[model samples]
Target: MARTAVPPKKTIVKKMNYLTGFLLGFGLLLSGCNKDDDGVTKPDGPDPNAANLDVQDFMYKAMNLWYFWQGEVDILADDAFATDAEYTDFLEANPNPETFYFDVLLFSDDRFSFLSEDYKELTQNLSGISQNNGMEFGLVAFSNSDDIFGYVRYIIPNSDASTKNIERGDIFIGVDGVTLTRNNYTELLFGDNATYTLTMANITDGQISANGEEVTLTKEEGFQENPVFITKTFDVSGTKIGYLMYNGFTNEFDEQLNEAFGQLKADGATELVIDFRYNGGGSVNSSRLLSSMIYGTNTNELYIRQRWNDKIQAAFSPSDLEDYFAATTGSGTPINTLNLSRVYVLTTSSTASASELVINGLDPYINVIQVGTTTRGKNEFSLTMVDDPNRQGAPYIYTPSRENNINPDNSWAIQPLVGRNENSVGFSDYTGGFAPEIELQEDLENLGVLGELDEPLLARAIQEITGAGAKFDFTVEMPAEAFTSSKMFSPLKDNMVLDKDFYLPEIQ
Candidate 1:
């Protein structure tokens, strides 16, 4: 049989109402069963042995109805590939149909939307669960050559790396006796291995020399990450500056965030420095709660405005657009709202999504001095869809009723781009990422320490705080070879999530 596929042309369904049938994350019922010759009810569930065409059909229908940029996509008209045959044909004809289908519908050049067959794994990933050796390293080239070097960025507490005494700033020149060159770094260092040897190196007088030590690390399974990487306070010139090395916005660590802030509050710290250099982003609600902790006065003010596609927008009232976090967390306890007039955020190209949201969202109310490099520039968010019978606990309320067509085997769920987030005073135009007010690169040649006042990034922020100015030159020469492969590390999953906020329905 010819597989279902995307039709070559647009095919708008005149009878279809996206608002009533599929406004939120409801399954589409495009092709229902008809009455049999004997007038008996026929089974409408998709065949378990069939070509699996329903999955592709569901993708098209959901994106067409609720995708944030549905109108801008020319080929994604309503019911463009609504049938099983068309979707199946399209799939069979294209080797990478999933990528091709999703890519054509994205009008904003979004790269975050994805499909996962196992939502249980996705849930675990979102909760900061992963299997790995726990070695976060950054690669650098030696004076414009392919000879790359790596330095341990940080160690997860109690992980294999930490247990093995693989401290931050420990340099490695080779992997398993093989030098990490630009040509083979990705393959040699990032490939899956149960155990490997790290050939250590050292930096002295602006040169990298081998330390002649081979440290073997065995990979472990189910290592949960703690987002509160490091927290410390520094006293500089009679000024108390609190520094935090926050890695991601995982909600499981909300109490940890509070504890860190509580210490800062008790220590009489007047200045704050948040290092988001390695943070890609995670929960949106966590971002909001963090913002609330920073400046508590904006309880009634708009934190962000969610704008949906036209059809979905029509379903919401005007008041539904303005959203704000409470002065407290979901636990009903008051947060440590600092009421600070200024905040310093240390960022890099990896800083993105919810991280940028906090920066952009807090800009109108306080001084957000961005230090380091530009962010990853993602303002979109997504919600995870599960194959649940009750449809409870979804990001949005799934009110549409489905009659007897439940498929227990629907293990697949998609995290599609659902909406764009803009802050109060209506400013979210950082498509190319927010440029740093004071630019400085990580001094790998002299990586002083992780959370100390001497850490290059933290030192710069302190200099700015102490009125010395954000003027710091790179100790290493210009345009060094910089490579990143931490994303390839095991157990570090889904750092690019902004998953909590959704364009909600009125619930009438």
Candidate 2:
């Protein structure tokens, strides 16, 4: 069971189709009763009969105990409502339950905590499963302008977009033949549509203008997304430069990632460039493995320190808080450690979570030359908690379960910010985001093929490695009349997460 950590807010996930089978099961189990506080059988026990009020009660109690900022929730001591309806009425009159219970209940300025009623969809997302059109994009506008332009960052292979010959660096100015204004872009890009017609654009006189090329693409169910998008070794003036365009920290492809590193090591690569411009983050274990491979022979060293809430801190031992690097996978598979003294990274505002972890975790032991724009500042991680009473345990439960691991009957689950992560030597102060030593934006003016030496961001990294020592600027002036979407097109929200060995058992 992998914990779904909060990704950079910019990533846009397509709305999921609920599991009809689960809904049917929920409907069938609604009549079953459970032991309430008085040990009397009641209609609400994590079942469909558990109304919104019942669910809210569960959420309140769970957050009171497990939330990282539990002490700040003054409402914890006010759970004195006699019935579910009374509790509902109290919440309605509070005027700030949503704010107090959900948003403000987290550490100040935290935006990672999220609630979901679709546990199946969330679980699938954690496992790298989702429906996607296979195009990842970034929205850019001139400073302080509402007008935005759509920039193609990358295209997933074998996706509908790729099949339509849509390539990285392609710019779109309109959707469905309508000029893309900031007002209509979100609806046009993320609308519930089976198909889309994209109008292309080109840079003319330093301005984005319509190119009159329309490409129609359709969306389909993309089951599993492999994070290893591109891996190659570039020969840069006799220096073997290894380049890996890794996008996420999914554990399913651990072996494949190891193989990529193995290839670079076997090729005797002297320099490395990790492209994380669009990576939001994923599995903490995967982060550790990647760091271990990069750190090479430095296995037992502490990679990250996870600090839970004060209550959980006192309950768990020191061993539970420390996450160290494993030279090999748990099954004793030896990882390919690059053992490089310095590693170059390409980033953007979207580079976050486990991606930042890799960069920060390796900083103490190696020279991490950050290239490209600043990274998304997310140092905290979250865990997915369900409505299982026993799992939430003691003081938090009013409806006790007779069985130990009975699954929940409803889909409600919460991915709350449970802990903050720090690297070795306690270096975790990058809230505003980590800026690049060699700052350069992606060259949308003259987009180059990805994994190529001439690509704007990658080119800068190579230049740094070769000691050419030249900095390039790719920032463009904001268009006078443009619109940008609030969020970029992220196929999935499950980026960098901490993989939990156990999951709250399935809802019955």
Candidate 3:
């Protein structure tokens, strides 16, 4: 049979009516609060700084170019009745309005907002000032480099002490008094740090929850990084399992990974469980490095293929391909070809971007298993941080590129690539997420296995790797008719096992 080539799928379309309704409602909601302290009315006008600058300058100077660019593009393409105004008209008719608008807004409002908020929080935490321009904080790093670590280190307000309120050594226990556990902390910390009243005991205190009691500590200036933590190896039956809890793909993350893997391997680790319940994304290179280490040199292809705009395609140099290939085959100890793979990844709605990349990259070569909910469908790769000429420093912008579709021959062997811009290309293997071989949830009220550790997910994964039976099983008798209609009653089936004895599949 001749196989038909699948066109890329369209991006998910959200109903704009709800958005329009919400905007109108929000306007009405704020209408009553528009008065100043003396009850005098105020007029809406661009700030002096914004008014004096060129439109290009305003657009490029904004920090969040991604959101602003989309809005500007909509104004140009959708708002046909709009006057042929200076900056607005130029953006609408441009060859790549999305990219151009992203550059402009990224320079103008987005940059200013991000810096302002960062500064505002810094001042509020340090000087207890209610009003400030909010200029003290800055982005320290953002990349998908060789290392898988992303960081946003802000300067302490009005002090150069080696350690600020939330210094390098402080362990993050909670955010806004919401206690964080292994599973959801990654999503909570990504992007801007939320307002949190943190409580901390001395690191050496070794504190555990008391009977009907909680510890309340002092408030301090703090920042949150993508959640990444290390824990002790535990025994499931007779097998030893090493756990590495990863939250996101940050720069230089591979180094941290290597150290964890090395320690676990030395400790006679036989199985590994990686938790990605709330990870969003950071670097593709970081994902590649981890995949390479797990699959080893014998594996040829890393990712199936990346889709990008024609401009991006033209920009690709020979070194880029070479570097990608080298990164996939260069690091880590080789896995025994004959061994059954046992890797458990916990996922949820927040598991997206590079998280999907890791799953698609490793599934074909290893005994990969997914636990928990479906993954967020975000297979489209975007080139963010484009430079804008109007900004003083580097004008960082995020733009939507092209679509990527993996060849069918390589789809199962390599990771599946679903198009974010097109609607027809469905991710059949795992779009919403891969269903876990075993499902479990923790009970938070009892704090038994669910306090943030997600004991149930971890325990089930450990059981599968160790070949251990369930510690407790409760069966409720049900009617046959009920069983027939329930999706949970579906018959068990066999999966097509990839033959490792055969040659590794080549990238088509």
Candidate 4:
């Protein structure tokens, strides 16, 4: 399941109502959401004074109010700025909002928080829609130099890369015939160009060199990737093992995910394996539902606990502080549950955010046999917010009920680390990422086909399952370090996000 919120520090929060009394009177505190015509609750634009406020003003106010580490950041103190002028001056100190956001507002410990130039793009990204060639690959640096080569992880079906000659396990050392180096790779490969060529490479004797091959790939506009990448059932000595190579916890594809689970259940699959080796993360709601499908749909059990900031968490009851196992999809469709007690999770450095959530949240309930390498160590989740005038887009879930109410003044959006997610037993400390029980890393030279049972990670999992197979050598010929993956280029990078619009509970 997608994770959200860390356990709050030891601080006594008084019993307060939905914090309509937020002490900061900078006029940036939410006065609560507004209802539009037909009496539907919608986002309110910023406060009256926010009309003239710049983007930095928006960033500072949002960080001060909702940043998970607000209590620790001295600059974010409620009384740090005694006068409104000082607050405004602090915002004005950095004219560039992005600069100010990175260098100042964000907590140093936070690694996954993000800011975007356009909320529309950010919203589409969180939903798994983006402009892309759809070749999901990971970059690895050469052992000697800053030069990096990319190994194809997987190809998105119906994508430009899918039609091209490039496939999983292929290696590329350059873009448009230019040898890729650390400094110019971003500009050459991920620039605004709609199309580019990948210069193929091969590794031999621990030496990576160009193979004199090139493939041109084009970025498709509005490419929508389904998170349910590969789903199949493996018959292992009369025991049915269902395998799902899920890529993200995207909420828009929840129906598809449910259907995949339904297929596994239909196949009489008793054992389950979820391959998240390359999955970064997405919607927490989807993660919760996905977990419920694997585990039982027991609404009584807590799936995840959220520890909000002291300013607002006091308003929540114990029940409100937690997200329980869902009985059905948020759309009310009955979930197709495998109800498996033990699950095998395939992970890598790229398996992160919600992927880690599934591992951590289910740890207290089920046997999660994590294979492959450790994860990307993100225990926090981000809230999708736009520059709404209403408390500067006070984080509400990016749901249909409310209009995003984006301040027409700007197109910027911010996904701040607002909560720390813990499982039922209060285990939220995987910031260094979850270590694998079956410590294995992908063999770059022999990156096998994804689902055909011969893929190294999956094969190793099968070995652990059937118990009749001989051991295979886990060796790597490439001498390099994994830098990043193709998902890093996506607008929503390593995010396990809260999609439900959260306006503070009806102000008492």
Candidate 1 residue runs with Cα over 4 Å from true position: 1-52, 79-95, 117-123, 140-148, 179-192, 203-209, 318-321, 385-413, 469-482, 487-508
Mark the regions of model 3 whose C-alpha exceeds 4 Å error after superposition.
Answer: 1-228, 235-237, 314-340, 380-387, 390-437, 446-454, 473-508
Model 1, range 150-182, lDDT digits (tens) per residue?
Answer: 888788777788788578778898988999898
Between 1 and 3, whose lDDT is larger?
A: 1
Give me the candidate number with maximum TM-score: 4
lDDT of 3 by residue, 142-206 (tens): 12222111111122333332233443222334434555443434443331342323333232333
Estimate candidate 4's alpha-carbon lDDT, on a 0 to 1 scale. 0.74
Ranking 2 against 3 by TM-score, winner: 2
Error of 1 at 180 (Å): 3.9
**How close is every model to the real structure, measured as TM-score?**
0.79, 0.79, 0.47, 0.85
Write the residue-wise lDDT of candidate 2 on 301-364 in tens digits: 7888877666556655576567888778755789898888889999877887788888888887
**TM-score of candidate 1 to 2 decimals:** 0.79
Per-model root-mean-square deviation over C-alphas: 9.0, 7.6, 18.6, 7.4
lDDT of 4 at 162: 86
* Total backbone collisions for each predicted model: 13, 17, 39, 19
Ranking by TM-score: 4, 2, 1, 3
